[model samples]
Target: MALGAHRIPPGKAWQDPAVVFAPSVLRLMERVTEEPHPDYVGLLSGHGASRPGRVELSARGRIFVGERRYPKGSPSPEPETFMTTAELAQKFRANSEGILAHECVEAILEALQGLEKVGDIRGLMRLL
Candidate 1:
């Protein structure tokens, strides 16, 4: 049971899904960085459910609370192109991953904000 957190209902992730919704690439990233739905409580008994993830992204990089990291890099497969050298591939992959991670963190943050503003699982139900 979640304690000391919101019981917001379900609906939007607060942020624009478009920014974070990359189904094709979603598989490549990690989960939320913080507890998911910290204030989530079941309506029937007012039992606070497990908190949602609280994702965070900083200059260091993306961070998921309980997820694995997807490392980025390129192989020296005979150095395919002028740009895709081993180092270039690694850099490119890292940049791409960073972008994706940043987006996710941003989205989760928005969702949390929404939850905070709405207040209570009852308020969240209105979202549905």
Candidate 2:
């Protein structure tokens, strides 16, 4: 599925899909830096694209929480969520894995809280 100019790769595992959607998510995060409202729902929903809804945000939140509890890539227990990324992908017809990356999750949370200005896509890309 497409979100703005980015395409969500279908049927991919969570570990490998961020490359496709990170650019678009980064663009949205940059846009949010200029907005006054913390429209997390709007951002995750793709400005009403029908996928990557609130549930995706919740899932990302879980990932964030998981990362905080364990060292990065240290085989931490799976964070609980309302739905799995695979299920979300199937339901929304869009790969939900992109938003689950640790960097993407952190960037998104920072954007949602108005805590950071995501103007440096290159820096973020380097992190990814």
Candidate 3:
């Protein structure tokens, strides 16, 4: 049975219905956003060549990738997950402000490659 399933006392409100979110998604979201209003975003795990898919910033700024059917570690392109992630390939948004994830990742790696680099979150944040 799924965690967080509504349990009943054989006659209680615990059986009202399953909560909207699965326990796992809730826990992962909590961990991912633990930085306190951190600049959060999404990335596609599977490549486009395998089958078109995408990850996007939901209106709530939560990372939503394809449908629930296409969740992480699940098999790719289950038909229900046929999505176009090309539009998202060159773009990433933070707090609804658009930016480029590829360029940002590149910049971060570049900064890390510097000879005088010190391992610091602030230093990395500057790359974005």
Task: Judging by TM-score against the true structure, name the best candidate.
Answer: 3
Task: For candidate 3, give the lDDT of residue 61.
Answer: 61
Candidate 2, poorest ten consecutive residues by summed lDDT? 64-73
37-61: candidate 1 lDDT, tens digit per residue: 4434433134222222333444347
lDDT of 2 by residue, 72-91 (tens): 22333434434554454354
Q: Estimate each model's TM-score.
A: 0.16, 0.17, 0.19
Please give, for residues 1-128, the per-residue lDDT of candidate 3 as tens digits.
Answer: 12222332222222334442656545645544212122122323334323223334444667554324243334565664443443232222222133446567656556655737666768677665
Question: Is 1 or 2 the stronger prediction by TM-score?
Answer: 2
Q: Which stretches of candidate 1 lie over 4 Å from their true place?
A: 1-28, 31-34, 42-54, 61-128
Local error of candidate 1 at residue 87 (angstroms): 43
Q: Model 1: which ten-residue window has the lowest total lDDT?
A: 1-10
Error of 3 at 87 (Å): 15
